[model samples]
Target chain A: MEQKTAIEAFAALAQETRLGVFRLLVQAGPDGLTAGDIAAHIGVPASTLSHHLGILERAGLLRSWRVQRQIYYATDYEGTRRLLAFLMEDCCRGLPELCGTALSDLVACCPKPTVDA
Target chain B: MEQKTAIEAFAALAQETRLGVFRLLVQAGPDGLTAGDIAAHIGVPASTLSHHLGILERAGLLRSWRVQRQIYYATDYEGTRRLLAFLMEDCCRGLPELCGTALSDLVACCPKPTVDA
Candidate 1:
């Protein structure tokens, strides 16, 4: 991602409501949630939530699709991956001993759910 | 990390200069760089860089220490971990099948430098 794009993504996540919306959609998974459900879950006004959603979409952190009269929103996995890649680009700049484990541990803390369990 | 702290960190990183500084320091590794060096590398006036550095430091994304009269800055590994953890908290929220690989693929993209190499 370019610096401008990265800045926009960071700005999108910098706000409380937008961050909440992103995380909510992330937890909602591929199926996503309708605008009404998101507003209800976040206890925000529909109009206000709509504004936040637009910002997130523009920043590439979210993808929204219209289903019937309602709109569904989900995390944009590819956009997210791009942002993460930009952050870790040339991480530690060759000092593997210092950051190899540190970066890995970021995701390690939240274990991926097992299929059998 | 609390929503407030996460917001602060994201906000700190949202700007062009601040983000550049953080990424530069990350590349610099644990030994960090002096404030003068950061200013010179980023091509910003020392006073302006100082302000940006303060915001980043307060947001917990960077740490600074005094080495003689020069203050050195480096990425704060703990704060970074907390932010990443917060982002991935309850990821997919039980829908492992959808996000199991997606989240892991984040750090996986940047191959850690091998010790023997």
Candidate 2:
């Protein structure tokens, strides 16, 4: 990803409302959530959430489709992953060996929960 | 990291000049870069680089110290990692099992280049 695109993704996710919306959509999985559902969970007016969703889609962080006159939004996994890669690329200097420990440290921070329990 | 802190970090990195400076600093490794050297490499005046550097430091992406009457800056591993974690936390829902594939996919994108080459 180019610097400009990475910056746009960061800027898009930087807002509180936008961040919340993105998180909700991510958890909702590939099927995503309807626009109305997002607005309700976010506790914001439809217009307000719509504005945030527009920013997210523009940033390539989200993709939406109309199903029965209702908009369903889902996290753009590829786009989201691209942004994460962009952020980590510099940190690792694109050299995994050199940054092995650092990468390991970050992974450790993400402990797998006991989902099977 | 809070939304405010994330926004500040995003804003600091959103600028072209600042983004360049940050990547240079990150590549410079934990030792960071001297103010004068960064200014020279970035092809910016000392004042301009200083301004960009100030924003980076304030955003917690960097940490600097005075050594022998000169300031040296380096990427703050902890601070940087915190911001990354914040971005991923929601996507993973704090449940690694749910995001296992997504997490793996992102790691693959970081394919460790052959530093041995």
Candidate 3:
């Protein structure tokens, strides 16, 4: 992803409500949660949730799809991965040597790359 | 780190100049770079560079220290790790079988954990 894209994604996540919403959608998986369900889960007014969701969508951190009458919002894994890749691009290239400490911490937090990866 | 800290860090990184400054510091490694050098490398005015540096420092993404007449700025690895950990906390816990795709992408971008890890 370009740095501008990365910046927008970061800005979208910088707010508490949006971050909570993103994590909730991430936990809810790729199928995501319907707007009503998300609002109920987050205990926010419909208007507030709508605003945050719009910001996330504009930033490309979340994607929404319509199934019947319901609109479900989920974390855009591709966009999310792109942002993650952008941030770690420089350090990971150096591998286990130069960025050792940070790299180790990152590895511990990140999962193993499966064959599909 | 608390969500507030993470928010601050993300906010600091949301801007182009600050993110450039941060990546420069990260690439510069733990030894960091002097304020003057950072300004020179980033090609920003002294005042603009200083302002951006202060924001990064306050947000806990960067740390500065005085060595003789120079003030060196470096990525605060622990603080950075905290933000990264916060972002990945929920998904990583679900492991390979769950948050799979995003996790795999993360792993591909991250390094392997050392024995000490």
Q: Which candidate's lDDT is highest?
A: 1
Chain A TM-scores for all candidates read 0.86, 0.81, 0.83
Please, what are the lDDT tens digits per residue for candidate 3 over residues A4-105?
A: 888999999999888888878766767788999999998999999999999999998899999999899987877777676567555523534555566454
* Candidate 2 vs candidate 3, DockQ winner: 3
**Per-candidate interface DockQ score:** 0.47, 0.30, 0.43
* Model 3 stretches with alpha carbons more than 4 Å out: A92-95, A107-117, B92-95, B105-117
Lowest lDDT 10-mer window, candidate 3 chain B? Answer: B108-117
Pick by lDDT: 2 or 3, better one: 3
User: Cα lDDT for residue A77, model 3?
Assistant: 73
Quality of model 3 by C-alpha lDDT: 0.74
Considering the two chains of model 3, state its CAPRI-style docking category: acceptable
Query: What fraction of the true interface does each of the listed models get right, in terms of native contacts kept?
Result: 0.57, 0.30, 0.39
| Predictions in order: lDDT | 0.78, 0.71, 0.74
- Residue lDDT tens for model 2, A1-117: 788887888778877899888867766667789999999998999988999999999999999999998999988877877676555554534444544354444532122211110
Candidate topping DockQ: 1
